[model samples]
Target: MKWFEIGLVVLTFASGIIWLLDRLFFAKARRERAGLLDDGRDPVVVDYAKAFFPILAVVLVLRSFVAEPFRIPSSSMMPTLLVGDFILVNKFAYGLRLPINNRKVVGIGLPERGDVVVFRPPAYPDQDWIKRVVGLPGDHIAYRDNVLYVNGEASAYQTIGQYVGKGRGEEMTGATLLSENLGGDGRHEVLEIESPLFASHGAGEWTVPEGEYFVMGDNRDRSDDSRFWGTLPESQLRGKAFLVWMNFDGAAGGVDFGRIGTRL
Candidate 1:
């Protein structure tokens, strides 16, 4: 769990407990001592609780059940999501899961192909990873010769042009940009690096098991994804990324105001 989340949970519980205890045992005495039994309020601990508890509770609810913001840390997602983009993930889009534990208590929907999702990799549970869903349960997924195949049908894509990356995206400069239609979902852009650091072999073929998803980065060959760590467990899913609210490209020296409010 994130340290900030842990802190919020702790503050919420502590303030709530202080308020409850004061109301049950010390409120009347404190009020009487203040010389106005009917109108006076408990001063210190109770005041702190009253002021902070509600605010903390509201934040926890909104962040845990509605939507949460996450910062993109790497170029794995490339043109679709940049290194510094601050994105909002729809927490309840797929299902409502408990914070920290990430156990889904409500099943609202399932993941669809081409959906950008955030999840905890089974190989590294503490680290949050984001990728595009390529195969759903029972689907056959494969990658060969820089192309994707789903259930014997090759993915259709339109070559847009050579990607001219900037800032931290500089490394992807010579890559090919393709608008790939992953079927079911509308087309999205992806980068195909000519010379990949890691090559996909026969092991790239995978039959997605029930309650699992095969995910890949839009930056194709450069990503360490399902092709490397295997399918992601549905239970470890966080949410679907929908929008980019802010961006600060350190390699580019500063923030790019134009990227702010850009939809993902």
Candidate 2:
């Protein structure tokens, strides 16, 4: 039951191989016995396709349950993550669960504030989203005038400087860079666009209910995350994003060799 995806892949590959072998070897003999000329063309293409299916399926399983690859589509994570950065998520770090269903059959651990995580969008469950955990279950969270307050304790933010725009996204240009501290555990940079004027501002205090978490993007202005939708359920968590293996931005040209092997 747990290996359902793997099973399906294996079955499909086996069936294809049998069909290909039968057509390649036995078909000629049968055709000749019936006084027909054989073309002698081996249907290796079918076998190749069949083999590919299992390989793809294995990769899918590894990505979903183990580590998954993700591209920084937007500047939401900004300085910590770039528009073309390719990152890897630690799938089993939170817990091992069946992909798609997202039911946590194994409880390895829970998410803590300040951890960068990937989860299905609370508003749109079909979409996978990445954000930094701001509030855990039962914590009060609020954002006003671009400052974040958790449980009445304001997170420390020091003005670093202006963020220099790079790449093609409008979200990356003309933003303020600040070093944000999540209660001394970690320090990371976040971007706040000066022009936008904080669209989700003036929100009242949000008390995260049990079994849920409040999240936000590092690029404070451009992300559509927990601030707009809601808190992410524990079940919807995909994994903890921890590494960048490769980066490819077509507009910026080929692979980003410098970004490769960087830890998140």
Cα TM-score per model: 0.93, 0.78
The lDDT per prediction is: 0.87, 0.78
Q: Report the lDDT tens digits of candidate 1 across residue range 113-203.
A: 9899999898788888899999999999989888899998999989999999988889899899999988865999999866545444324
How far does residue 14 in candidate 2 sit from its true spot (Å)?
A: 7.4
Deviation (Å) of 99 in candidate 1: 1.6
Which whole-number lDDT from 0 to 100 does residue 206 have in model 1? Answer: 90
Pairs of residues clashing in candidate 2: 76-219
State the weakest 10-residue window (summed lDDT) of model 1: 194-203
| Tens-digit lDDT track of model 2 for 162-236 | 777655554465678899987866888898866555755535678899999998999887787788888888888
Judged by lDDT against the true structure, how good is candidate 1? 0.87
Off by over 4 Å in 1: 36-43, 196-203
- Would you list the clashing residue pairs of candidate 1? none
